[model samples]
Target: MCKAWDRNMYKLRFIISFQVQLIINFKLIAICSHQIFL
Candidate 1:
């Protein structure tokens, strides 16, 4: 049971980190586009 809980926690953490990374990448792309426009 403990192992299952731990695995779930790891999955949740991984998802959050993945989302954060995606957000950062999106922001970077937006900034690059804005710079090009200016």
Candidate 2:
């Protein structure tokens, strides 16, 4: 039971971190596009 719980926690953490990275990437892309247009 303990091992399963640890695995789930790790998976959840990974998913959250991955999502954060994606958001940062999108923000960077938006900034670059805005600069190019200006």
Candidate 3:
């Protein structure tokens, strides 16, 4: 049971970090597009 719980925690952390990276990437793209338009 403890091992299962630890695995789930790790998965959750991985997902959170992945989401943050995706958000940063999207923001960077948006900024680049805006600069191009300007």
Top-TM-score structure, candidate number: 1
1-38 per-residue lDDT for model 1 (tens digits): 99999999999999999999999999999999999999
lDDT of 2 by residue, 1-38 (tens): 99999999999999999999999999999999999999
RMSD of 2: 0.4
Candidate 1 local Cα displacement, residue 34, angstroms: 0.5
The C-alpha RMSD in Å for every predicted model, in order, reads 0.4, 0.4, 0.4
lDDT of each: 1.00, 1.00, 1.00
Worst 10 residues of 3 by lDDT: 1-10
Backbone clash pairs for candidate 3 read none
Count clashing residue pairs per candidate. 0, 0, 0
Regions of model 1 farther than 4 Å from truth: none
Candidate 3: Cα lDDT at 17 = 100
Which pairs of residues collide in candidate 2? none
TM agreement with the true structure for every prediction: 0.95, 0.94, 0.94
| Candidate 3 similarity to native, TM-score | 0.94
